[model samples]
Target: MTLRGTVRTSYEVLTSRFGPPTFPQVDDGGLPAEDSTLWLIDTPAGRVHVHNWLDVTYFLKRPAAETRWSIQATDDAALPWIYKSVTGSTAAFSAGVHEFSRYSTRVSLARGYVTYLVQRMIALRERGERYDQGSREHRHQIELSRHVGHMALQVQQIVHDVEWAYADDADRRRWTTLPMPQLADEPESQHWHRWTRWTYRPVPTDSRPEGGDPDLVGMLRRRARDQVRFRDRILPANHRGPTREGKVELYDEHIGTLLTLADTALPDTVEQSRS
Candidate 1:
């Protein structure tokens, strides 16, 4: 196929030689695998894929509304995961405000782990421990410690804001639904997940949405509000039953200076491998 056109690239010579194109084939894995000699590229909204030559012209001619929907779906799915994590935490134990409190406990553990690591690294440096040739261990420890500290601060701020999750009856009166955000996926070790939080507020009869739309909106708002209230009123109040305590076992731990060596030596090892 002869390629032509700059911003608007075309390959019309293919049709002149091969007649018209057949349907694109789906790969064994069920993915659309275009086999055309020349494919039109698309990177809009991070959709890095090739399209059949015909699709390029078709997409260009499609209505803006269709393109807007496509863009929204791609961009919406690409948002960061951290927001999902905490929001999901609340949703898992629907109607249990205590569940949110429990999430605060996990946050505390993350904060403490970060603090302990930072202190341990600092103590190692103060004791004149050996550093790698590039001193990457020292630098990495510092950078990780800083990042952990920042996350801790942000979590602390969010947790301290009582209004973010709690509302008095007066405050609740303003809305139809409560937000019940849930994690989109399991957290990565201790990383965040992406989630959506929905909060509903009451609309006056005069200001309510038009005809059928208002009814649909009202239903959604009520569902959201009920879920939020369920979390707040149900989860935490029912905690003291049998108090099933599990047996605790402790194992002797090792003081591995080995990790320190690996952490220090790894970069050099990778460099050697490349050489």
Candidate 2:
């Protein structure tokens, strides 16, 4: 079969196994090559993109249009898991049927575990305990910490996306109600601040509803600030020593705060964290 025809057949099989999708699949147009087909499925929790490119197919799920908790699978090896995630059954596949819900739960647990390790590392540093620059343990810790931090960032992004997706109208309005700012005649530097200023102009306090939760905007702003801080401070000091030590605390703090905010905003994340 043609690649596009194969993808459509796979999607049909999934729908038949899992019932109909939340909404009808729509053609999302193709790339410049015109050798691919892209279809979008809008679900209650998020959107799925089915991309058929040459001999390979990719299924990508994004919650609330956010890259967090996004899942992508390519080829037959990954198709079973995607199907199981949707159908909550592995009857269609003889083997290798993994569920997205379980995957999300495992990610959450790993994120928590990594946060604990970071805390311990901070405490060790606080107590003046030092590890040799070339020590195996020190290098391992640094590598593992970096990986965990990256994973946690993904999870937090997903949680925030879900929270934003399901937030009350008032909370949602905080984002939607803002007026878009016009770009200056001469755009400023490529820094995030410039992007933020261009994308999200602050709303007047008087315009917000009385007693409305301002935490939504605050969280978004903090996330942006932390991102800049991470890019500027932590990324540059990728080594073991006083330079990294000086920046580690702030990095951990930013990540920790993000995790806390995500968890607080979406306490029942595992239940609806599928992407």
Best by lDDT: 2
- Alpha carbon deviation, residue 103, candidate 1 (Å): 21
Worst 10 residues of 1 by lDDT: 245-254
lDDT of 1 at 94: 16
Q: What is the TM-score of each candidate against the true structure?
A: 0.20, 0.23
lDDT of each: 0.28, 0.39
Supply the TM-score for candidate 1.
0.20
Kindly list the per-residue Cα lDDT of model 1 for residues 1-275, writing each as its tens digit: 11111111123432332334333555798744663323222221122121234443343244221221010112211111111121221111112111122222222322222233333334434433345536656554444344334433333333222222344466544432544555445432222211211422223344433111212223323433443454345335445422111000000000111111112212111123344
Stretches of candidate 2 exceeding 4 Å from the true structure: 1-129, 173-275
- Tens digits of lDDT, candidate 2, 4-25: 1012235444444445333334
The segments of candidate 1 whose C-alpha lies over 4 angstroms from its true place after superposition are 1-78, 81-134, 137-145, 163-275
